[model samples]
Target chain A: MSIGKVGARKLMASFAIFLIATGFGMARYEIKDTPPNLSRFESTIASGGKTELSGIVVDEPDEREKNTRLIVETDNVKILVYAQHYPEFEYGDELSVSGKLKKPENFSGDFDWAGYLAKDDIYYEMLYPKINLVARGKGSWVKRQMFALKAKYLSALSKVIPEPYAAFMGGLTVGAKRAIGKNLLEDFRKTGIIHIVVLSGYNISLVADTVMRAVSFLPTVFATSLGVLGIILFAVMTGASATVVRASLMSLLVVLARTTGRVYEITWALFLTGFFMVLHNPKILRFDAGFQLSFLATFAIIFLAPRIEEKLHFIPKKFQFREIFSATLATQIFVLPLLLYKMGMFSVVSVPVNLLVLIFVPATMLFGFITGAVGMFSALLSVPLGWISFAFLRYELGVVETFAKLPFASFNVSNFPLWLTLAVYILYGFLIYKLNRRNTRKNQVA
Target chain B: MSQKRMAILLAGFIGGVLLRSFLNLGWAFAGFFVFYLSFR
Candidate 1:
């Protein structure tokens, strides 16, 4: 399974070619020119410090947060709408916000409307008047069916499980975090266990493994297919986001590689995943910071986490404390760079804070799932589950509050230059190469 | 390295850089670096 230098060289070339072709193809698409009487989406207008945009219902402003801008789309063109008196706008609602069209600052890029759709991957939708409420817009029926089935299954599971445990577990297992309170979310963030809240590949695998174990009595093919189908259903139920899709594809590729007894390269899997995503929507490559962050973080975890974990393996295997500490350190080392780049903060106490928070995350999520499931079945279950959910919520809140209140919990890294960050990344890469090579040699002899 | 794999990697790296430069998408360079380290 080791990739020698020769193999690496060949692979690198192929990847480069692929990237060039794709990049050229992406750049070839002509972006629509702005019309003379352009309007922006209402939400965009609300973000900016302006008023009188159509469909804007002004809300009370917080004095603390500043420099927020909004753009509103109306009448075939996008316009910059100020955030002075913005209204509450639900996602997917179409509004014809009329305003004076102006080119906004700080959004210069190949991707049209990159500034407006940084959080939302709706760059492509700018060409059209209405934003699709769902991803792909083709899987709505299947998604609905899966959702209904999930509700049914959760309702049934609630009969046997405790209250909030079910609710938390639902979130952990299925990626539905609606029931998770804001306080719990804050704790998970501080602890770096927020990935657990998001239904990543890890969660998908956990659910799939459980299903496969339950069906082990069946033949291997049937069991494997059942597990796959179950996961696909779960993915749909969780909205089948780009990250989830990438994870599912990677997991599926891994399984297929195993079944075929051929060692598939993970790097290829990553490239192919990105290639497919970009092929589906070229605009995704341009806009969508969440898509960018999700993939980048996963890349860091895959490529960098192992190098870190190997360095800390001197501690005895059976020593539970060492294992937890090493695991936390490894993941944090990789996550920190990307985290800072995205969030502009370097959490000084994130390591220890995450260690403490990790202890409760699994349990909290389990209880949450249980409670959420129970609530689906009856008021009988909801009553008890509500109390448990509340308890976990309270504990989670306390943890976040305490950690956040710490003297040096985190500090801003916004002032850091991009070159410095890239230099750090290069150094990190060299370190991993040296460390991994040494470990590989040791492993070969052992 | 096999010719095929080498070709793929080189193409991805060079092409990514050129595309990023041409399209004015500076982030493509970062993506190329990711490809280099990851696929390299």
Candidate 2:
């Protein structure tokens, strides 16, 4: 599709996402009824101490206001079992608890499971055991193994890099923690390079292509299948967080479209991904800021990047790196308003910071992966591997540190209304579309 | 460039600037607007 069309679509889709998200937020504010569902359950010796109940887990640790609670159904469900255990249970786990539910007490923070579960109009009841039983699904075993393997590789790769540089390398490779260190991240934030740190379509696709290339000896169909499986495994390993999942899905879709010799529609593909993810967990629409930001930023790239590229086509391809840089800058332009609307802070240095960091990011990731795999086979080689990896990361850190030190690297804007953010995006879309049209006609006349 | 394409381009430029102006992105939009018009 033409760049202008993509830009227009991006403008519309983001607007839609914003509206739906607002609707969910509004629902949370107004819906108030029923006392907290406090299920208390105890089993007779005949039934055994095990109890099973169904519940929804809204597992957002940060947004305590949106804590998860289960509505379980049971015939003799009046019993409330005090689930005396850590509240860090994964979201969406169904349980058959053989425990007792207790009355409401002076508990601080959000609703106690006993009370909250009861209020959900759930059919089952349980005040779970303090020494409780938790079983992650056997169905999730394959995904779990993939995540373990991916994380293992990431951690191993970090060992090869120097103290602080290892963290940044890990972030680039496997979307590992904020290990790139706070100060470096601050630099990236300032230069608008934070997207490089965040798992994005470029990172995922590069890795996917690398894996596919290695398996090229296999039949085309077989190799494609393996690549898709690898992508899925990588997504699972990355915690299948909304952003990671979305990027992985897009990468996989792009590959699938290309392999089948068909034109791909990135916007529709992205829209479908968002729709499916939200359908699976409607609460994510309200509760997950990462989910919103990931989709928005990516949508901007797919829609706006091309239009910007075409408008500036006067630049020679030999200097084509400028196109990549401009595309990055343009996406960030649309992304910043939404970022500021949600994050309350925008990094002024992020654009330059990202440009510098991205130049090294792909190379560093490749080296990190090779060293990680090598270490798995031979610890003896780890030192050299570690040395090489560290060298790449060291330079990366130096650049980040320098940019972060610049004045006005970060600033905050509070209470920017959603309407204003949306309007900015719409205008950006119109501008890109206009530029592309002009450029296309100029080329035609030439 | 055809007049139609240039018109679209100018429309986008003007619309973007007006919106940015309306929303108060500060002086950055002025330089951008001038640059865009000069290109046309």
Candidate 3:
């Protein structure tokens, strides 16, 4: 009646497969069932007149250069409002908004603006809305406090660091709501280093590594506990958005694996995390590009980076250059096809630009955190650290700007087929299989 | 299962999801059926 090890393994694998299959099935069913009903809004929007609605701001105000985007919810429907930056809004402010309510429209490119918003159940938008704050503090107490703390952190960063650099530092440390300017954002896109600015798993992983090393003098259990606590605090500090939560969970698994010396177990944990995320929000599997890229980049870092490092004999190991190089290469390779398909832009100089910038990221983040923390208390005391952080930020911006201006820096691939993207990934899977088989055979011989 | 089979299985599951995303539900079901047959 007892099952052998192979039998047990098979049973576990079968269970995993069943669970994943169910998840996929559920996602497909949800997508098929829940089409957005815009009939109610459409009738009002088609009137071509100003509509007045009162609602509570449901999410953080997305601060851009000239305007701030807010999601206002009343009853069951949520509307995206673009309000002037002068009268800034907080997360939980109740407001009466008057504007021309219109359905989200697609831009010139292949971007499906409506479909993208549909993932979040947002169908209508108010452009340049006349918003009056009716009340404040309508959201969860914890979120309001988190947003206030984030605002104070950004204000502290600005006291010491100049514009653009201050904004960039804010992005690196706290996922600041402020924009880093459209031109600079385009440069980041062209150079393919945009992930650095966003609160991605890569950034969280770096933070986790820094925490682990900082507390390495302590016992393994204590250090791991501290590292996890730091990650949780970080997630909470950043408003615990879905993206940050996912990154924190992935980083947490990685820290646990390193501390427990259980690398294989971490792989299952990683997959389970992904499975649960998809199960919770089936729309993200198809609609959310950030979700897709986060998982793919993490997977490449975990599995492909080491294999790539073995072949990168020419790269020096000093300063962890080889490790960074392998990681950058693996992630770029793994995510490229999807990126090309989703955003028809491809950066030819992404590798060189990444190498030039990534080496300073860890140090920049360290000094940047110090600058903000100290600046909060005394701006004068933080100036020295702020200057050091600014130098790194300036260099990174210079590299991105210089490389982005090159004639062959990037190219546009219009209408990339989905089948081709799938084909590329399948080829990748085949190559990985061959590589794993060869490694196993070599181990047997050894 | 062998590593190759495992990779194929994983790819098949992903392919089902991708097909469901890009195409219709029917294609996704068909994609899963093909992989199920192959695995068998």
Please tell me which predicted candidate would have the highest DockQ against the true structure.
3
What tens-digit string does per-residue lDDT give for candidate 1 at A97-160?
Answer: 4333333444533233544343232221211122122121122456546666566655654554
lDDT of 3 by residue, A1-446 (tens): 45698888876677456546544654654564365565767778778746898999988889888888999987568899998887878889999998899888898667778877877778789999888999999978877877787788789889988999999988887877678999999999999998888777767767777877898899988988998988887787776656677778877887877877876465566666766676566567788888888888877887788899999999999999999899899999999999999998899999889999999988898899888889889999999988998999999999999999998999999899988998998898788778878887988999
Full candidate order by lDDT, most accurate first? 3, 2, 1
Q: Evaluate model 1: give its TM-score.
A: 0.64
Q: lDDT tens string, model 2, A274-388?
A: 6656544433443455666777667767766776666676656653466667667766786788788766688877777777667677788888888888876776788787787
DockQ, each predicted model: 0.19, 0.02, 0.23
- The model with the greatest TM-score is 3
Specify the poorest-scoring 10-residue window by lDDT in model 1 chain A.
Answer: A55-64
Model 1 global lDDT (CA atoms, 0 to 1): 0.54
Best by lDDT: 3
Better of 1 and 2 by lDDT: 2
Residue pairs with colliding backbones in model 3 are: none
Q: What is the lDDT of residue A430 in candidate 3?
A: 88
User: Candidate 3: lDDT of A154?
Assistant: 86
